[model samples]
Target: MILTTCAACAAPLAHDAPRCVRCHTRYCNKTCQHDHWRRGHKQMCKKIHRGGNAEQYHADKKYKEAVAVAVEACADDTNGEEDFSTLRAAINYMGSLIQLQRSEEAKALYRKTLPVARRVLGESHEMTLGMRTNYAMAFCADPAATLDDLREALTILEETARTARRVFGGAHPSTRNIEGGLRQARARFALRELLGQAVPGELAPPEPQLAAAATPFAAASAIAGHLGMDPQEANAAIEELSELKARDPEAFAELMQAALSGEGADAGDQDP
Candidate 1:
């Protein structure tokens, strides 16, 4: 539910309590409003506005808080246990962590519980399949994930999806979910490949003299050396990037930003 208490003091507001003029964050009185603004709301106001105002923003925050609490409880309850219940809790916990963008935490949980889950539940079991699906998803959720990471995720999803289809059939929910994850992983892998190709070869030049000169040819040679690519392949990629930038500056900028920051690669394809 959306938080209705005063933003500053958590006091219940009257039906007509004053609200921030911009973000419409409710306050018990003018003093509380001013205090909240001074304390932190000044910085949060624009974010609140962008997040669909105070009600939606606070509601989302509240939901995430509840998920966090649940995750902690699951960790406590499932620790050192190797039963079905523990496996279930671990899967749910990993999903919550992924939702929270805590990819490292989710990955840790997966590594810890996956072996036990496979042994106890068997590979074709629905729970085991679900856990595998979520683990692959954790890779895509990681903002720092590289091309190799995406490739790993795609590989896992492909194998899991095949197993799910054979065990549960294509019409089953488990198979469908795994298939969906596979599709997303495939797309992310392809996109990452394209972005990798577009990346400037100058990131790691070869010869010290060539590296110092800052030329695309030198950069391509360096990239070829580092990535074990043919120099011609790197040069071709640079040419493609140049043509793409010239043809569509905005699209090129977006792709470049995605490649550099490792953003927009999140699959968000986990089954609830």
Candidate 2:
């Protein structure tokens, strides 16, 4: 979640909280804002703006903290500690990396530690199993992960689920957890496959002429075909699009540009 508290005192803000006009860093009142500015925001305001505003800057800061904690935990685990507590801490730290969308970093850590974990904790140990589960999850958690990555994750989950059921029995919590992970992986794979089928070849930006020639209803119908939506849902989407275009023409124009360019809408252009 994004930080919603004052920059100085960490107090929750009211609807009309005072904020820095430059970078939009919020505070409970002008006093807190001034205190924060004198303390640090003066030097940090431009940096925060460059780092995608206050919320994203704070989130990136927390991700760095998690990275630090994970590194320390892993270092501690490496220093002659084979106990469950240390191992679990290391595993959980890696999980925090994945949860914070640092999947590549999480995967690197998993590769480095999995062998050691198996040697020290054994294959069926809960810590080892948890590490394996999280490693598989990282494969699919990356935003840029492809269909092959999803397949790899599914394969790992299937094998892990089978092992958990055999070793821990069906009613065991570990078994249940692995089973749940397997189910989710399967669902993700299926959904990805369905979408791939919808657009058989590599997806290219819509042709300008085709887009211009198509009526809104016709465009909606085509989109519905690709997304497996019904006619009513397509109509509803068109209505929503119409409302958006009417309410915020600039935003609507930006959305169109993004669609044409095959890029995402700029988050910086959005209201904080």
Which candidate has the highest TM-score of all? 1
Alpha-carbon TM-score of each model against the true structure: 0.59, 0.55
Task: Tell me which residue pairs clash in candidate 2.
Answer: none
Kindly list the per-residue Cα lDDT of model 2 for residues 93-208, writing each as its tens digit. Answer: 77778867688988887887788789897888777888889988887566556678879889988888888888889999988988877766665555445335434553444675
Model 1 clashes, total count:
1
Query: Model 1, range 1-272, lDDT digits (tens) per residue?
Result: 45568988999989999988777899899999888876667545755776788998878877876887786687677545676676777888888888777889888988888888888888888998888899899987665676788788889898898898888789999899888877666655554455456554434334442232233223323333333344335545455556776799788766554433324422321110
lDDT (C-alpha) at residue 78 in model 2: 64
Per-structure clash totals for the candidates = 1, 0
Can you tell me which runs of candidate 1 are displaced by over 4 Å? 1-54, 78-80, 201-272
The whole-model C-alpha lDDT of candidate 1 against the native structure comes to 0.68
Evaluate all candidate structures by whole-model CA lDDT and list the values in order.
0.68, 0.66
Model 1: how far residue 12 lies from native, Å = 13
**Candidate 2 weakest ten by summed lDDT:** 212-221
